[model samples]
Target: MKILHTADWHLGQLFHEYDRTFEHQAFLNWLIETINSEEIEVLLVSGDVFDISNPSATSIKMLYTFLREATAQNSNLQIVITAGNHDSASRLEAPKPLLESSNIHIIGTIEKNSDGSINYEKLTIPLRNKLGEITIWCLAIPFLRMGDYPSVANASNPYSEGVTALYREAFEFAKTRMSDNQTIIAMGHMHTHHAEISDMDKTERLIMGGVECISATAFDSEMKYVALGHIHKAQRIGGKEHIRYSGSPLPMSFSERNYKHQVVIFELENEITSLKTLEIPVTIPLLRIPLKAEPLENVLVELQQLHDKNDFEQAPYLEIQVLLEEPEPALRYKIEEVLKYKNVRLARIQPYYPNKKESTSEFNQQELLHELQPVDVFTKSYQAKYSAEVPEHLMELFQQTLIDVNQTEA
Candidate 1:
């Protein structure tokens, strides 16, 4: 049986205010061709089906349309999709009854029995070949949240331990149902310990914090292949080739501009036989000018040269980085003026400044207080007291309070 593993489609994503519908559509079109050409039997989409929990109507349409078309193209192909951290479990699973009829299985959230015990049977799915023979068993586990896993009261690192425990229980149950000739595959949307993260991928870090990372040991030896999602970088965990993250189909951020996005193909001949990566063709390129920080004049010169050489239609999405001795208020305007008639679309402007270390010498407290703005002073006070940045809404309320106080004084 041939299986295609992919994740982090992030459909309905707006890349820096620019609609990525064309790019995503092109990817899906290519994927369909690949599926047909490779004669893939099972398609595993680990997670993050949409950019947000509540996706736009267009995104939802694109997802269902692709699924319907793919299944129609290859009647033998079966698809299994699990909800990622970005997905709303209920929303993703809303049409489960309809989708399953088409051989498309969706495991969005954990189900429970009437007595509140988890229904592990619902999570385990059997994958059949063209002959309708059970060839493999899939433990389709979605992103687990607090209270979603088996509870360990008073345990240290309950979240991590609970997640591991859940996988163990599911895998053990899967073992019971598996035949001697059948292979077992597991799917998850999680951050495993020691997974390499790209420098510029900020969203994943913010979403999967340090506490959420689980050890690779969580996956036992019974599993033949572990398809993972959540992380945007494609890599094998703990140097095990079978445990892999297919990564996002497209570059989600500027940090991933140089990343080679691809889908993984697993050729299972009885046991897992061969794994291959088919790199996705770049529909729209992401260009970071200067490749590194440069002076404003140098950046403008490069942009002008690039304008003369490249056509607008095929131009890459551009991000400009300028090194600065001090803050330049008109930096954006200056760059925009250069790129106004250029071929590229300006997506970001990053200003780099030299880091200045504060001295250990004594300083005047009164002078520091006098130099700070009212808002800055309040921000510092709030941070000192709470050890967190003031929330944006609270900061707005503080500004309004200042305005009211000024009016009363006047």
Candidate 2:
């Protein structure tokens, strides 16, 4: 059996303010061609099919259109997709009945029995070859929320323990249904303690914290392969080659500009013989001009040189960083003037200033508390934690949040 593994599509994503529709479409087209040419029998999409829980209409259309077209082009192909943290479980699984007929299996939410127990049978999916013989079994486990798993009475860590118990129960049931030579593969959408994260990933950290992460030992040792999602960097878990994250197909942030996005392919002859990576071609490049903080004059010179290059259609998305001791009120305008008629699109402009001097004398708590306003208290608390004053942009955001809260109360 030949299988392709990929995850974190994040369709409908906006890079800064730029729409990524064309880039995502190009990737989907390339994937279709790769599937047909490679003669892959199975495709596993781990999670994060959409950028947000409420996706745009265009994103939904693109996803289904690609799936339908891919399955039609390859008659023997089987696809298994599970819901990620970014997906709305109920919404993603709404068309389960219709998609199943086309050999596409989606596991979004856990089903419950009348007695309020989980219906474990629904989690086990059998993958059969063209001749209608079962070759492998898949434990399709989607992203687990707080109340989704079984209750663990008197457990120190309820969430983590519940997750482990869920996998154990599902794997034990699958063991009974397996034949002598059949393989058992596991699918999951949560973070494992053994996985590595990319330097650029900000969202995954918010989704997968220390309290939410499960250990790699939660998976059964007998399983042939464990396909994981959530992490944007391609990596193996606990140095085990069979357990892996295929990563995102596109760079999610400017920090990931140097990352080589790819998908993993597994060829299982008897016990998973070969593994290979096929790099996804870059449809549009992301560039950080100067690559580091530089003076305003230096940045202007680089921008002028870039304009002279005259690379129009394929010009990369640009992020500019300016180093200054104080604020340059017209910095963006200056950069835009320099980039006039340049091919590149300005995605972001970041200004870095030296840290303010700290007070040498420490005041008593009583004196400080008496003089502080509500906003002052908040700023002091933030400075104590981060060791810096809140940026002007963030302070503006905080004021807006206060306004929103006041309106809600009113």
Candidate 3:
């Protein structure tokens, strides 16, 4: 069986607040072409199909078109989609039945049991080949909703067993339903254990109590192959060979520039036989330049270094860091003009005035005020020149403070 693992599409995502509709359309086109060429048997989208929970009408329309096209074009494909934290479960699940007719499965929200026990809400979707001999069971674990675990979060022993109990609700259900005869392909939209991570990956550090820092053992079940997501860097977790994160298709942040976006193609016999990754080129270019030095000669030398490095171009987005002791107004203008010619977006140009003496603890009130708003040096002068007169009652408080000081001395 051939399986394609991809995730974090983040459709309708804006890059630095700039609309990425055209870029996203290009990505989808690439995806469709690749899918057709690859002849993939199963397409698994782990999560984060949309950029936001409440996607715009245009985004929704684009998604529907893509789904329709995927269903219509791929006759042998069994497409399975799961809801991420960014998706609305109801919205994504709305067309599940209709899509099922087209061999597409939508696993959004957990299913409930008649006995009031939580069941595999979106788990164990199976596809059978002719002769009923070959069966592939897709175990989909969508974003786990905390509310689905009544026995855990709201249990009598909430301190230690809360999270463990909640996870057991799903694991226990999956264990009971799993069949040894069928080939199980598990997919989840969560951070897993021992996943190789790079500093350049755009995923922010999960805080002490964040969701992404979940225990990897939660997924240790009787599944042959595991496809995971959430971390934006494609990697294998737990050294299990089959477990993987396809990562985002594009660089979502400047920090992610070094990370190459790719999709995983897994060839399965019993376990993941072999894995091949196809690198997807970035949609838009990013440029970063570090300029350090001071004075005309020193700054000029830094500029020379940038020019010699072939970075003096205007086609890509730019991040230039200017490090100087004290750049003059004229020098700043010069740098801005040169950067403008290259069509560079100045990320930041830090001014370092090393000669400026630090203020002492015994500094006067006026000096302190000046320190507060150093750039607006004339604020104190303006206030003193044209400020409103102080009220008598407020002025008397100042006088009382002086009197209290004098009494203390006496």
RMSD of every candidate to native, in Å, equals 5.8, 5.3, 9.6
Q: Which residue ranges in model 3 land beyond 4 Å of their true spot? A: 130-134, 150-181, 194-212, 291-315, 324-410
- The TM-scores of all predictions, comma-separated, are 0.87, 0.87, 0.71
Q: Where is model 2 more than 4 Å wrong at Cα? A: 307-314, 356-410
| Minimal lDDT window, size 10, model 1 | 355-364
Instruction: Sort the candidates on TM-score, descending order.
Output: 1, 2, 3
Candidate 2 — what's its lDDT? 0.85
lDDT of 1 by residue, 1-410 (tens): 99999999999999899988888999999999999999999999999999999999999999999999999999989999999989999899999888767789999999988998788899999999888989898999999988799987886888889999999999988888988788888999988888878764455544546778888899998789999998899999999989999999999988888788999998885777778999999988999988889988898888887654266555688898887655566888888887787778788998775442342222224447777788877876655444456777888989999999999999
Report, for every candidate in turn, its global Cα lDDT versus the true structure.
0.87, 0.85, 0.65
Tens digits of per-residue lDDT for model 3 on 274-339?
Answer: 789988866666665543424455554455444322343323555444444432457567766665
Summarize candidate 2's per-residue lDDT along 333-364 as a digit string, tens digits: 99999988787889989877555445322332
Better of 2 and 3 by lDDT: 2
